[model samples]
Target: MVSDFRKKKLLHVFTSFFDRNGSGSIDKKDFELAIENISKLRGWSSGDAKYVETQSALLKIWEALQSRADSDKDGEISVDEWISMWDEFAKNPSAPLEWQNLYSKFIFNLEDASGDGVIDGEEFSSVYESFGLSKSDALVAFKKMSKGKGQVSWSEFQELWKEYFTTEDVAAPGNFIFGKTSF
Candidate 1:
């Protein structure tokens, strides 16, 4: 956990990131911009990192934001709502999730969409449709994830997760845009 002082600093920085306009509040676009900025800084691939746009991971983030921001039927986040969400985050920072396990489970869940622990194209497509991603995304992910010549096994998924998630900056990884920051 971060100290209150650090959390406060994080809050300030995050709010600044979210407050794109001079209105001193966050709208959906501002939040999306913040997500985009994080990807820039973190060197996250479009598929690896999430934005407010539709994607499996993004859906989860948006769900949390909806619970926090979509109050009073405004479909937008007021300053108060933004502060409330910020406070919630300060009080309980999201645990640093392990990406390897996360990626594995993501594929497995897609494979086992029916909850029977089996994978089919139909099931994988369900997860893809949920994220507005194409079935080709899964195919590509699988192709890269697969180590053996023929088919991908669960173990191969882990290797793919590491290689994809742990690229040495975005340039080292494909399909990632790079940004330069000054010291």
Candidate 2:
């Protein structure tokens, strides 16, 4: 089960990414702005291959978020909807198994920068860095998850992703998925 503190941390991470305008909600515009922001961070020009790839992945994530959190069918996700989704996950995370799986798969694909269906240390580190984790903290988490392996496979990644969202263990490597949270 997810602890209250962990739940709050996850919510904070989600809000940080999705609430681009700091408007307490995620709408299409905010989602698009997030894509542009990441594109700039990665130094992707409009016609670059990597830019296209990034846009594709962002679109997938955007659609998934809207499908899951747009409860009013109004094309926007209110803060209530966001919290409700988290509460539902906290209560019975498996209830939204399909969405979770799809979201995780999208993340895995995005992180597989080599297109090899695996996350190498650098790729894993990038994921952690995106959440503002320090390099040392990310390395520690990667080492823990990899267990001496040079890379983490899709199965392992999926397991870690689920644990990060569902488990309350403070020391779980997955707990570091979003850097450290003050609980």
Number of the top TM-score candidate: 2
Worst 10 residues of 2 by lDDT: 174-183
Candidate 1: Cα lDDT at 104: 45
Q: Model 1 over residues 1-183: C-alpha lDDT tens digits?
A: 334443443344335434655466555566455456545543556776232232445335545565555677566666566555445543433332343234246445434545554444455444443433456654444333332133434554344334332333332311110011110
Looking at model 1, the pairs that clash are none
lDDT (Cα, tens digit) per residue for candidate 2, span 122-175:
876776577456666667767776765788888887677766766767666666
> Residue 87 in candidate 2 has what lDDT?
65
Q: How close is candidate 1 to the true structure, as a TM-score?
A: 0.33
lDDT of 1 at 63: 51
lDDT (Cα atoms) of all candidates against the true structure = 0.43, 0.69
- As a whole number from 0 to 100, the lDDT of residue 120 in candidate 2 is 78
